[model samples]
Target chain A: MNTRYIFGIIITVVLLSVNQAFIQYWLAQKKHDANTINIAGKQRMLSQRINAEFYRLEKESASPHLLKKLVAEWKTSHFKLQSKDKSNKLVPITNSEIRLALKELNPNIEFIESQLNNIGKASLNLSLINQNQNSFLPKMDKIVKSLEKISDKKLQFIIKTEFFLFFMSLIILILEVVFIYIPIEKSLNLANAEISKKNEDLKQALTSIGKKNRELEQITYITSHDLQEPVRTINSLVNIFKIKYARDFDEEGIKMLRYLDTATVRMRDLIKDLLDYSIIGKKREKTKIDCAEILEIISKDLALKINETKAKITWGRLPKILGIEAEIRLLFQNLISNALKFQMKGHQPKIDIAAIEKKDFWLFTVSDNGIGIESKNVEKIFSIFHRIHSKDKFEGTGIGLAHCAKVVDIHGGAIWVESELGKGCTFFFTIKKDQNKIVGYEQQTELYITS
Target chain B: MNNKLNSILLVDDDEATNFIHQFVIQDHGACKHIVTKLDGQEAFDYLTTPNESGLPSPDIIFVDINMPKLDGWGFLEKYESEFGSNSSKIIVMLTTSLNKYDKERAESMNVISEFRNKPLSPEILDEIVEKYFTNKHMVQ
Candidate 1:
């Protein structure tokens, strides 16, 4: 769009300069033609002066010096006017009539010059000088008239050529505006309309997403409240029956009651974890959190389990990062707890936590010496409710890793695991340095609702 | 003992929850008379009008948040407008909602005395009575 205008202006400037140079050259030629005509006119007057002076010398007996000077002046001017040599002094003779006339005057000028050279020694021919001067005057007049006509023709040609060049430049300018500039403007308008239409579509999509998020939130609340209500009643009623009718129950009935108790306890824990996962990003604001401090708090919370397993926990210098405090704490807690829980039978657990500074974020790792997961099931660990071990072997709802995944995602990062069936596992995750770059679901929903 | 409450009101949409709460209150012997209503609207109507049994005004009203025909918040609004602020009656919000927003909402209102979870036990009822009422033995 911008280059078209620049190219059009450049072409116009080139055309104008070409016309200017041509016109200047022609004007300079016209000045030279006028100079030549002035000299031809002067030659005619000098011829008459020489003739009259000679007549005066014949009758009054004056010095021949004055007559000689006039002849000398007339000879030089005639030579300059009638010379056919192609040099600076040569005037262009275009008309054949003017050429023949200048040729006739040349001989007369030479005859007068030869007579003046024999000043006092020979008698001067006064009658012959008069006849030659008369002939020279008429031809010089015709030559001057011809030179004037030629100059006028040159001037007319220059004017007509200048008009033609100017008209051509105007046509080119109009064509440039019609083809280059107008079309560019039209395409720019079209692009602008397209961009605004896309913006409108994006706004509508954001609104619909906000509505969906709100509906999902409502469903979570309903599950937590309404669904848990009946479960709580059942659990409590069983407890009440157990307390009131313990003596009446046989061994088989007692076993069934204990099974019911276990099932209800597991169901409650499942519901609580599901609620916690769904409520991850309800707090949209982020704050600076010290990872070392959070790890210390988590280790203290798991002191009982750590003591029972005789575990050795150590960490390198951790960083202060921008994230939701609770979510980040939960992330570390889950990773550390998993490291403590999944262990090799009768083996001492050793866990290490460390962080490395990357270009745009901080990479963290939690490695543990435990009963490692199989390589095939490594990718499946972060999925909700995906457990590799049976319920009889491990006590877990398989939600901890999935919760860690959610936390990392909200912080604009990723989570993955590297493990083998017999070797220890290393869990890796990233946290962005700038919290504002995080486009978590909660932030987008809040923006749509508030705006 | 002055620790005993004169009259208590129990409001909930769930029949089992109200039954359990009423039984616990009765078992604790915390109050002289106990009134049970199906929902917040029925409880509000019962409190506003004179009863056939000629029961006294309740000292503590346990209102559940989620109910049909005027929920806990709606009933509170109507009660506040009718009785005005600084009423002597203690209003406790009882529900099964685990949402933090609901707890924050209950705390923000001045008319609500406390927020408690569902299935009120005998120990919880005894604590409420001991906290609000004067126990002459403790004073001695």
Candidate 2:
């Protein structure tokens, strides 16, 4: 089950337990009130019984022993009602009104006891009999009436208490439903609706972005293919002209033709590089690739340049990773070639390639002792066609490092450089251990460019 | 590089590319007869006509991929259907497309013997004639 439902159940159980405890306390109080009413009624009955015995003794003029026993019983009943001896007394009425009624009845009870005592002393005194028949019997009746009133009042108090408890229980139920349950349910529904709406918006944005990316790829592919034909035609015609009709042109005409030829070649390179940049992750073949093997191949490919420049290249142990072998080779080639191309005047280029095994990837570093880049141009170096040096100074299309950046990004990694102007530079890039964790080329390319 | 083939055909949409390629072929002197067609449709029509019309079927046909009337793939499809039995004539696909898919398709097709990038040179012409025509001629 969901946790929300479990939490709600827990809250409901707690509220119900609290309500049940309150009702139990009220019920216990009601039970005590009923016992108090019962005790007061019993006291009223005893007082009435005593009054009847007194009348009987006055009229019959016989059975003095029975009269004395009855008098003793009345006295005992009165003491029990008052409960002066708390330990031995049975009835313990703690209500203030009941105690007040008992106090008022105490004087009447004492007078009746004294009158009975007098009758016992003089068994045939007419005046004592008259006093008992008139004043004492009426006083006993008043005491019984007061006890009945106290019982009635207790019954009314119990009825009011029960009604109040029922009303309080209903209010508590409404409060729990209104304050806790309803608001929580309403907010939960609102949050669900909001999340679904945001999800839909995100889905639509992703779809549109994917469509735009595919369109851009198609446009790049077609433009590069179409653009190359004319460039090739111009280069071919110029070559034929330079070969077949070179003696027919003046010096200036020949120089202009050479310039045209150079421009056409550069344009072709630019178009080819653009196409390569666009198709970074279009189709990839992933295999277990050894960084050491790739570096060996790159060194062999650049052997002539290395010999001419007298550059020294060394490497430490490299880890075996999963990637597209050709792309990795290209990446290594570009960085090593850049190192060779950007050497300081009369300085033998020293390039070092190494890989460190990280938790999820291999961090590869290519350090070169060449003319390093300025700090501000570090980010700009990876942007397409962003050339910091003029073509005369540095013969490059400026897409080499950008292509390397794209390749690293396709492998779900980051690329950056730490360099100081006129000093040596080190370029660091990562390659994921698992090729299956590659990101989409379009998204990663955008991130690489922006970041 | 003695003349190895009787004739060769060049199919391309771009006039400049055809002109330069024809110049290279003529400069190499690899074949006595050379024909240029504006598109694949013109080349197809020229090839399918009766051989007795004083025009011999070229031993090699270089077909450009992007054309106005009929593209290289379209011509290849029609050419295979029309001339499937003519195994002696070789068809080579030529284009400036660097797309790997195009290369793979050209390699996979039975009618196409080779795929070449555009702007053919005299050395390439000489190589093609020596590789394909000279051996066959010597065998005959």
Candidate 3:
């Protein structure tokens, strides 16, 4: 929503991502360490059990001669202890052939201990006991070796797995830092910078526009007001010249004086038009004005020009409008005046004043039978200080139509002209219809009574 | 006859305008000595003053709207209240400005004659002069 909020969110997001990752990695490492330690403990316990069993077996199997004597004793003890399991009836000891053989082989095994004495029977007894047997000691040792080997391999595998996970977690941390956190942070900074730059640019643009607007306003004021001083001075100077030097001058001097007078008047008109142009936007003087009455008044004022041209004005119903009465009068006066001024040398000006019903506005046309404008000069006539006709042809500073344009702009209307050279011209303009005032009442009461 | 006939006063700041008015009035062979004052206050003082010699009391006043001090409208505002008998004086508005507010205000005044435009035309001149002439002759 704001710079501060964006910064706060970025910090929040970054911290959350880092902290969550840290927490996840830490938990994973803890789980791994716990499993590793548990496995190590189980391996140690297994090693201990294997060592104890191997030691006990080693102690018992240390002396072979003693082992044989113990074995014979264990056999006799085993026979007596196993009597219930196997003794349905007892056979004499000398009657069993296996025993007879064992007795022969043992003839001197117990009695003889000489260095060269014949010990074949003892050897034979040893062979019989060794039949169908594998030694427990070597097998147990091999088992222990294999178990140790397996646990060692398991420990190595677990360690490697934990190392790989540790490195993977680190890589993930690095990648998150590089790809997610760092770039997003960078982008966030860039976003803030870009917006800040744009904001600054916008502010600068607005500030300059405001400054320019004020300067333009000030220039307009100075041009309209301060510029009047020199014009008034020139007018006063002309008056003084006419009073003091008029009698002394001959016909040419008088003609020059008249020329100066016309030029000065043109200058005055120009200034007034410029002032009117500038003030149009600032002026908001609008009241309910009867448009038809204004037209009738303009008709009266332009009577002399119309008479000179021998023009006839026909009218379709002109509706009442919302405008400053004086300005609208001036607007109509200018249009009608132009029509009267631009008459063909011999032709009587036949001007028609008519209003058209438009969708959103009232479109009015003032068509003339005067010598018309060229298509190109129609636009030229509305420019400041631009005159299509020379002074000898038409009298104006070309500011009149410009002023009309400005007024129409103030009223939110479009003013355009359609003309063919040497034929006739029609000036079309649109003004918003004031829906607040009804046309029927004003027309019936006014048109009937006034005419 | 006495109520219908009275002296008229002309109050103005511009000498030329008043002179032209006097000339026009005299050209028509009306009264020779129409009382004139430089300002509204002078006219007021004259009207309310004692009926002294050379200070003929005014029956009507032609007041120019724009003046230096105590303008025509201002004079009328004070006249009706302070000197109640002065209300009988016909007060005419003479101004260049056709401001509707001024016209309405002038019409609403107690002793107002009518709101009219300046450079009073020959037609109005003859009409007003004829009425006052008969009244003047009757008084004589």
Q: Pick the candidate with the highest DockQ.
A: 2
lDDT of 2 by residue, A342-427 (tens): 98767899999988889989999999989999999999998888899989988989999988988898888999999999888999
Local distance difference test, candidate 2: 0.77
What's the chain B TM-score of candidate 3?
0.79
Error of 3 at B29 (Å): 4.7
| Superposed model 1: Cα runs more than 4 Å off | A1-221, A440-451, B1-7, B26-33, B48-54, B81-85, B134-140
**Off by more than 4 A, model 3:** A1-330, A352-359, A374-380, A383-403, A418-423, A433-451, B1-8, B19-29, B34-36, B48-55, B85-88, B119-124, B130-140
What's the TM-score of each model vs. the native? 0.62, 0.68, 0.48
Top TM-score prediction, candidate number: 2
Residue pairs of candidate 1 with colliding backbone atoms: none
- Name the DockQ score for candidate 3: 0.10
User: What do the candidate models score in CA lDDT, each in turn?
Assistant: 0.82, 0.77, 0.62
Model 2 misplaced regions, further than 4 Å = A1-177, A439-451, B1-4, B48-53, B73-87, B99-101, B108-111, B135-140
Estimate how well candidate 1 is docked, as a DockQ score: 0.15
Interface RMSD, per-candidate values to 1 decimal: 8.4, 9.9, 12.6
Report clash pairs, candidate 3.
B7-B59
